[model samples]
Target: MSSSLLCLVFLFFTIVAEATYSPGGFHHLSSLRQNKKASKSKPKLPFETRYFPQNLDHFSFTPESYKVFYQKYLINNRFWRKGGPIFVYTGNEGDIDWFATNTGFMSDIAPKFRALLVFIEHRFYGESMPFGKKLHKSPETLGYLSSQQALADYAILIRSLKQNLSSEASPVVVFGGSYGGMLAAWFRLKYPHITIGALASSAPILHFDNIVPLTSFYDAISQDFKDASVNCFNVIKRSWEELDAISTKKNGLPELSKKFRTCKGLHSQYSTRDWLMGAFVYTAMVNYATAANFMAPLPGYPVEEMCKIVDKFPRGSSNLDCAFAAASLYYNYSGSEKCFKIEQQTDDHGLDGWQWQACTEMVMPMSCSNQSMFPPYDNDYEAFKENCMSRYGVKPRPHWITTEFGGMKIETVLKRFGSNIIFSNGMQDPWSRGGVLKNISSSIVALVTKKGAHHADLRAATKDDPEWLKEQRRQEIAIIEKWISDYYRDLKED
Candidate 1:
């Protein structure tokens, strides 16, 4: 392989390794459900990797439109009968295959509806690099990796796919979780002529702008532990102060290294500590009723399990030791590493690309605070903007997402041009507060679950699923069926 291809492969594995728990460092959705007792293994859906145009801009405003093709992987299970709807998953940050494999909900329902299943890779992520690995790191080319361009890519891809397959009459229903979920809903809103409806799960559409509180993300994580056990919350609360105290002392860095079993001595970078703490955040997000492999090999009720450890910590042990032990449940689950290395978290070629994305368009305003479980760490806009500009040479657009896509004004837009989009959120998810949680209209609905974590409803039906999830999935299936029927009925009228 060429150096660029080698870089791509290295990045791919790095993301997958982190994805054993969390990918992209931003909030993600965990799907794929089976019965509590029935662990139905997901069969690999073979997909051919294809490429599409890079410079989609037709206005010819740029110096010269670079003609290039980006990769997109898809799986067509041949389930579609004549005129059956198409099920398209709007891929998020990471490889499309990961989303395709974990999201069994689409596959399960595809066979039921005889729908065609396709997973489109997000540009700049996975193997869909527009400029290859060389230009990928260049700030000039990174400007094209915005969500607007991505949605356009989906629109163009779907249009071409329909024409090529001669499935013009077939209605398309988009499905996605997290960032992709936001894309699904936005795609249906912007390109309704292309897709009939969208199922957006755990999409923080309103997380941007001043629409939702900035503290909502960490607050939700804190609540997860509090719900699990107040003792766990207390231990975590004290652990931050303990870690801070230890870090501030003359010998604090070395002490932390000893406590956390760091391979190298603790550095001055706060990211090391932040990384150790982030494991808790991941645990809370994927705290499913059953063990999940979305981010890591976490057991069912991971937050609860971690709490059990904190609640049983030895009375004389230092809070730092307790925190290390708790964090070890996540970072050192396999107990394979000789020492904890913070470099493993950030030092990756693929993660470097994701960090660029986070620095630019995907400026998720997440932070920690004394109000939450962890210590108060402000992520003020000025600092955030400065960091993005310093790192990516592009200023962070705090309100651009809402300005371009209609944040709080989404309700009015949906009421006017949007319908058949199910905005689902789990109450436990911090990202849920930023999503549409109530009915915007009859067809535009929100499905909120008390036990659902992140995009739990997007997972395949599981025997271990709570009653509420079972009902939620049933309602989603029914809503999707109605969307297809309504689309066909309207097509006949046309």
Candidate 2:
């Protein structure tokens, strides 16, 4: 996938790309899709939207540092007792409410633990923009936005919330999936005094500094389709070569647009190709067993569905037609947009914000090779850094995340302070390759599943959910219960 398009999918689970990122009545995709016939009877939770300060320089204290901006958050105490446990979601690249609406797993387990569910927005994302629309105007303002500072924000906000609610004794368990999941784990590593444990679901915690190969992401995406049907992978691989040939011919751009049924005439073949690549990447990420509308209106088993489309390559039909037909399954699922537009501006999913993150500390090396289903593409680190410098005047820090947090030093952290943390990963998820898939210590566990997608275990439980997820949740609940029990026991011992 192109770097820009790749940034778009990073927020596929957290940011709303097609729709507005507003706090309104939005139901879980699994529940809404399942209850299409009984939509009127579905009960809704009354989540309140609130904000907090956006400290410009979290490390330094100056008069200009005290700037306040809206950091949106949602709190649900419906199942909480006076001194019950608290469940906090470290929001990712999009709106906080988006994460809150989709993370029904936290709600499903909240009542059992009598926990208060809190979803805090990440800085510079969603409505938590520190500089408002002028965020990217002055590059200096963006300096305040970093993973370390965001973790500090959570620590500060949680402490303030505890004092305000008089629930200081409540054992806090941090929960997050994907990028948010990385934050959850790092938060525990940095602030163990505040959070008792963390549930890092489908987090690519080791995707940096050669811990996992840079090509692992696209390779896993290729495997998703290959596992479904090798024919699908071959056809997709051939489609790229066919597109390259077509673009070289006269009147190729218009002919390509006509074949794809695009609403607008094609301007650049590169953009169109990148958009299609992103579609495939997004489909693999949200290939749940049941229907979900997280990033797009995706049906259950999207990769398999995509394969079904690719397999029906009619005799004599052009290769471009076969590829376009498959791509439409995702881009035109809603049938609302007249043409496919790869907008470079900010999307509902905060694509622009995510792009800035990619340019800076969150530089996950994305490249394509012969090993992947797609053709070879250059992933030059120097070129990537130069592009970042040209765009944001910031150089890419490829080793920053691993340097601050434990990348290869994971075992050391586990030996020293890791306990009651669950790193759940799905076999089908490309991000799983970068995550922990083995038990590092007595209390640190990794739950792996064969039939799961990216963070599928983090969504609301459905009847169609695989048995592995059911078993995973059971173990997670038991572990959390023990953590809470042990915390209070240690408190008494002290």
Candidate 3:
């Protein structure tokens, strides 16, 4: 359609979006599409109104001395009526652009929401530059960049947006994936009144101890690997034995990683399901971790296997090193409460992903090597440092601390404040909400899909799959509209 006609359609819908929320006061957002359209239009105003570009309004800030930044995107909502007066926070400390500006991936949520979409560059990266250059230079300064601090920033922006976006307080929705899931759950808990609802998907909210629900997750991954890979388990078994002897050395990762690149155990053929965790585990392995009574870093997969993956997808150069870089970043750094391992020391076990849990933990190392060839190359570590890192950094204050997960503390806060919660997850999504619904608060509803990968379950890497990913996102938007209706209209129990 013509640009002029598109604008008119958007304006007309903006007014209708509000009424859609309260039709008959029934709490049934999922079924609201069946309801009739409201007979109304945005009122004619005396003053000239200015609208931001349909695209996102991006901004950044520097608050510390490490390697992170605070960033948010002002996403225009697709409200048929001018009802949304607030912003929606995507899960965790992340680049809000993915939720707002990355129109392609954020499929459903970004386009239609008229309310601003705020993406907070995690406290240490992107344009939300906190602390100056060399912020990640040491662990002491990196302490300021934690989940506690990032959550505080989420609240700060909500208030700021309310004042600037409009005088009226906009009902905000905290949305996100995996680590973002943690952010969404906790944000609603702490600032229940400020946020209307949260769409927390595939979040690891329950503590590591609560991981029992997903105990089969690793087995599921290993089984898939073994099914497709020839003697993959034997290779890993050998690697573990070797690690038994060398795993104690703090500086041994370099030597082990070299061998891992060529190890046959690592060479196993992974299926679509294996792709989820094998990819994610490799990322944590790159850093260091001690998990499941193992004493070795993840055995490196086969070089040919890694190479085949890189070849299947297009690349800027042949040097395309690791096949699992994006998966690694998504699981480890996930932008929620980012933790750095500035200086790693090994005990009985070498480095592991579990280090983030220890109160005495230091920041993760941020050398260009860890994130250089990261996918969506626009966010490589080099760019991360250039775009966000600030000068003077502050250590985290106690107030910045976040709540833990014995219960649906975060989701509960959302409903207490009168918000309808919707969590979106892919049934096969590995690192995210693949198994989160059973443990979440009953008040919150999850939107589940079967054929998704990570990040709302679309396959973005394969050659013939981008189109499929796009169509999946389109479907997600319609789901969001339905959810809004269910919350605002059908489930009036609130």
Candidate 4:
């Protein structure tokens, strides 16, 4: 990989990991539900949590490969009928329960379709560790944590589930958002016979191998702010240089600490930059139509709300202060947090697993140029490689994702072999830059929404949902119905 590719890889993973897995991170949707005040009338959870004995290594024949670990999953069979179709949520980088709770669309439609809802936790995430905490101790142990292995796990589990339930004739539809969405699409491609269809919302399967512009991700983020408020966008773009200048002066760090209300005071510009960047990137990811608690308790159209805060600053106010206020809207929206901590440690196992994956097969290259709102940074593959080697005793296989999943010539490749896969993307999401934005074939369809952010379509329906969002979900359901109907028709014909 080129140095530019390496820089992109670092930037992409750093933002995603921090947003999705870090404590109080931007994409911690489950935290929202969990943090809500409990009520006496709170409804009981609909699904039952269970575990499966998953193979450590599905390909190798060694003794260690035969070792099994208990993988976690959740199943809700209340709406299932005999021979009903199965709906599975391929879990992402967090706990299965978080996804299960946040993804209300499935539950909303389960009764209508008479489908059984199942959420399978990805191996090494949540409570599905193959080798416990020691899984991260070496490359050999972490080698079992690839996407291929996780896909195989899903396939085997689905087959076994069908057999146990005596529903081998039942059709299966998989649902995932973001990384899980990528898995959903690949599962259909790699194991088409196992699943009838996939709903891959905001899956950036085209992020690898220079398939998309290196600056597209940051550019989309910049555009989101620009769309919200041009003045807010310009303030952020100019504030970086101002921050740099302020950091060099005497008592500058303390001044920044006072302005940003940092809990541990400012040490360097890097942490402050990262902290601010996370708020922007994550807010973009979950910028739903209505107020949402996906990342934090944020108002409706959070990017716009953040922009409103920035634009409200008085004429003589400092741009740095304006930026901090905007970031605080994301970080302190609930008004519960006293002071912002620049860095904090977390016990999330998924973070560890993701870092290992980023160091290995999950390399997606990204870089920013002068044209982007972000500061220009050069990619350094040698430095990236050395850092990976020192930390994990491994080198990143930057080409492995495309090699395994087919990012290059994706439309042609998928049109030839893929079917019943919905590539749904919200233009507001930065990840959408690497997503399939056009229809590949009749069965392989792309559903693009301009105002949508991240996996807005996968979230549970709310009365506050915009008409376009509601229509998107209805179209998705209709497509899945056709897939199930077609599968049964084929079965009868055969």
Candidate 5:
């Protein structure tokens, strides 16, 4: 194979290694169901699942443009009053039900504001497949799946729903976490006339282009480990060298398979490295103050737990052994997974759709160096382009996101036109490296907490929530309340 092909292959392995722990709400659904079964008093689901007919191609004029698909959405009008604010959770890469269930902040504060709750599923995900399940069969069908198209879908759906409910007078506020957060913020920017404001939590809107350092992501992960324990960070940092030395010895791959308790034999050292990297990265992402099942069954302060395991390793245990034990905590925390699988498979259509998006417009660059806890890797755009072309017959538009979303001079542009948007980020989330960390204008605000995890503020409040997290949510509620109050005051004046 050519050098470019080799690079692409390496990149693919790296992505596949991490695919098992990719962020989404699907896992939360299973957890929620389990919790519900355990409860003696089973409560009715908060929102009613509904479908909306959406255009296949929102930006095109071709025959395919007129085609329609049934997009899934959930609605709860229990707290809605006449002329009440409409709170919409812009769906991310997974099922709308998952988001609606996990995003309890919207429901928690709905009654106080008398807001109507709506969560819309993105196209090609959940049951919103534009061409049904065959949408992934060809590039032509998958072409309809893009952020721009999804944003348009939201704008049109909000308009239609308002008209149907005679809610044209109701102010719309969009809420989303992670990628959905990006959509929520972009929705307000692109269709300000449609939405009064947006609460975008953990949204890395500036991750595209060269707006932030490519190393910012891995650096954040490294910092999380370093903060937990320097010794733990050093052990992980030196692990790659130890792994390389071990793999070159006799029966090395088999020894690794046995040590890690892999269900399947190890094929290459790179896969092992990728698997370990995924554990560290994802553990850092969901290192909540309280125990969380977002990625897997993890204890409260999972990073610290992993560090404690690494710090208290047996006297004769090898670095590789310690690493496996820590990683096991992430993958097999429930102690049910008999053996690790280096390769992972998912039936999530949303992830399949996300793969296409990552290849196309959502091309955020990430790399690691000596400064990071993981092994060093450079951001190779050419290699990424070759990989995307090989898989999808298209080149990634690295600059499209910046062009379409206004990444350059973002503060200046958004400060001028943006209003009533909350950019809330938890410092521990690696994605926060690319988030807006400060206020852009009086109306545009950023709420950042050092102890926060990925979109922790957006998750349901718990009895064990840290006081800081509670304060963060309280601040968000207050800001949103002001926006609604001001909107009504202005409407009365008009």
Candidate 6:
């Protein structure tokens, strides 16, 4: 009876083991053991800490310019660990001079965490010129140049990084400011797996579609012009509005870029650059779109100009300092003058309109030289307004002004995305209108700075004599990092 029982028990155990195994017996047992080990072991996180040269390399995605651009990223240090998430940076429309001065930056955070910093010429402006090629031809062509495409471009690059490392590298985190902020938000939304996190500084995530908030801009800009004083900015605002109301009729008067483009050196003859710059900044704070983008989220402007300007800008600036890069790029040469020093320009920012009477009256046009900024556009206005209103989550309008061509709206296309999104606005930014924050809904997390400006004026800062600016930048960054980390925590994969 004992022998029978023992034999039966051994047979039963053998049968149970075989039934659970993958059919090849001991070889199957070997696999089972591996599975048990895998279950117990922590799988490797996705990235590697690779050091890049302090000088970030830039090349045209197309064959045109054969031109070279030095997309700068003052790489800090490696991430703290051997296998932390990769950090890759891509920003919106800025020229190399921005890197030369490191204007509007505070990326020391990247190295502190062992992130890789890289900057690319956002396709058009800087040395990233598609000079010889008609790469950015029409709006439809420009529509192709989207954040969706940018995600593809970035993913391709990250895959190359993964292949080079020959390891399961962690995901990347994209960082940007202004339009770059828009890109960062769209990139994560478009490809969450590729980007584990993102930090958007002074980015107008909510204003990409419309920017009528400038009715309030005159006050803010004027107040700042006063150096936190009372009368300083007020005097300038009083003079500016009188002229702006008039200019909006002729050549969309205050839009300095188009006016500057047409008038060139005589910018001072009509109005000072201060009014133009103020209008440019204020109009854009609420509506950050390419000039032509008034019509659609995707634009009829060449893709390069697609990260549109919310308001039409005159091509040049009165402040010689802010005018050079764009002037040089478009006219293909800088005029005899250059940008005045920052301190000098800051002073100039507050001067009374009475001081420059003749110039303001003369250079300005009573006509819309740049057709896109005014009525009777080459493209239909009503349709663009409808699409734009829809894209930014505004109540759709049957008609407004626009000939914009992009068909995809954020609500229609981007709303499909769940969490994994972030946005930013500057408290001091004239454009951080209420509409932008209201439109995006519950899925996106937005960051606001205490004293930030139109863009990441804080991200671009190092040490501030006033001290207030620097602290604000830090708070902005912390908020960004927290949102990103939270996003990563929730979707860290199974």
**Would you estimate the TM-scores of all the predictions?**
0.88, 0.90, 0.48, 0.92, 0.91, 0.48
lDDT of 3 by residue, 1-494 (tens): 01111000000000111110000011111111111111011223211222211111123244322233435344444442344534454423222332333222333333356544454444543334344544444545444545556666667666765766454334566666555655676677667767756666555444232233322333333333343332332233233334434434565544434433321122221111122223333322121111110111122232223233444445342221233333323223323323212112112110111112122211111111111121111112232122122222222121122223334344454445433455555434333322345323445655555433334331112234444445545554555565556545643566
Screening candidate 4 with a backbone cut-off below 3 angstroms (N, C-alpha, C), the clashing residue pairs are 3-379, 8-366
Better model by TM-score: candidate 1 vs candidate 3:
1
- In candidate 5 the C-alpha lDDT for residue 118 amounts to 93
Model 4 lDDT per residue over 1-494, tens place? 11211111111342221222221123332222222332112235689889999889999899899999999999999989879999999887656776776688899999999999999998888788888866456887888888899999999999999999999999999999888888898999999889999999988888777788867877898999999999898888878888778878899889878777777776665566666766777787778888866656678899999999998898877777888889877777878877776644343324456667766776655556776556666544566567678778998888998888888887788878778999999999888888899999999999999999878898889998999999999899999999998888999999
lDDT of 5 by residue, 324-397 (tens): 78877877777776776664434433445766777788777766677998777676677767777888899878
Score candidate 3 by lDDT: 0.35
lDDT of 2 by residue, 1-494 (tens): 33332322332111111111111112112212222222222235557778876566678878767877767788989999877899999988766766776789999998888899899988887778878856554568877777888898999899999999998898899999888888898898899999999999988888777787766776988999999989888888888888888888999898778766655677766655765665676677778889876766778999999889988887566666777778777766656646554423224444346556666777666556797777666556776777767767988778887788878878776777767778998878777787888888888889888877878877899898777779988888888899999998988898
Displacement of the residue 133 alpha carbon in candidate 3, Å: 3.0
Q: What does candidate 4 score on TM?
A: 0.92
The lDDT leader among the candidates is 5
As a whole number from 0 to 100, the lDDT of residue 77 in candidate 3 is: 40
Clashes of each: 13, 1, 91, 2, 0, 47
lDDT of 6 by residue, 1-494 (tens): 01001000000011111111000001111111212211223233222323221111133345432333222223323444434556555634333233213323434565554554445444333434332225443332333333343445456556665565553454467766544555565576666777766655444433222333312322343333333323323232343444445445655533544434433332332333332332322222322222211111121111122112211235342323232222222212123323321111111111111111101110100111121121111222343334333333333221111112111354554455545455556555543442134334555555555544544442333342235545545655565566556655766764
Candidate 5 error regions (>4 Å):
1-44
- lDDT for model 1 comes to 0.68
lDDT of model 5, residue 257: 86
List the RMSD of every prediction in angstroms: 6.6, 5.4, 18.3, 4.1, 4.4, 25.1
Model 2, 250: alpha-carbon shift in Å? Answer: 1.7
Residue 323 lDDT (model 4) = 84
Model 2 TM-score is 0.90
Distance (Å) between predicted and true CA of 346, model 2? 5.6
lDDT of 4 at 242: 81
Model 4 / residue 358 / CA error / Å: 0.9
Off by over 4 Å in 6: 1-82, 96-106, 130-144, 208-219, 222-227, 238-417, 420-422, 434-444, 457-494
